[model samples]
Target: MPKRTIVLSLKDQDIEKFLEYITQRLRGSDYSLTYKDGRIYLTIHGRPREIEDLIRSARKAHGDFMKIHKPVAGVRRYPKDWLVERSRGISLSLLIRA
Candidate 1:
């Protein structure tokens, strides 16, 4: 089955890094990434477990980044469970560290 994920970002470099991050982590999964307007559409042909793993990994990475960089003022840091809930069947906008 193919799962679609949407990522909203302004910079192409960020999107590129996001794709590189995902590709490096999920080596076994196949991905088709494209950008339309201001959002990135990524289609992955992988298992449900893989999707969950990807989201979980992203959450961890975000947490680690926050620990080092400290989130900017007014930036909301979502709870772990909220991140999982927001996945909504593997569809979400990535929180990239800037």
Candidate 2:
């Protein structure tokens, strides 16, 4: 089944690199990635476990870029559970380090 909607914000210049990295990681996976309203909305079609793995891997592997783009103050983190609400049906809300 398709995963819940996820919106990612990437500066114009960063989009290329982000897409390159994501594509490489998800080489065999099918997903919907689009740019709209200055955000990259991605919907991954996979099992819940698969989605969890993807999110964890992305946060661990590609998170370096996230660090570079973080705010001047405070820390950036991913919650223990990406699923924010039961009604949302296991949605992963990705807040880019920006």
lDDT of each: 0.55, 0.63
Question: For model 1, which pairs clash?
Answer: none
Identify the runs in model 2 with alpha carbons over 4 angstroms from their true place.
68-98
- Residue 73's C-alpha lDDT in candidate 2? 67
Backbone clashes counted, model 2: 0
Worst 10 residues of 1 by lDDT: 61-70
Model 2 lowest lDDT segment of ten: 78-87
TM-score of each: 0.44, 0.56
TM-score of 2: 0.56
**Model 2 C-alpha lDDT versus the unseen true structure:** 0.63
Residue 10 displacement (Å), model 1? 4.1
Off by over 4 Å in 1: 58-98
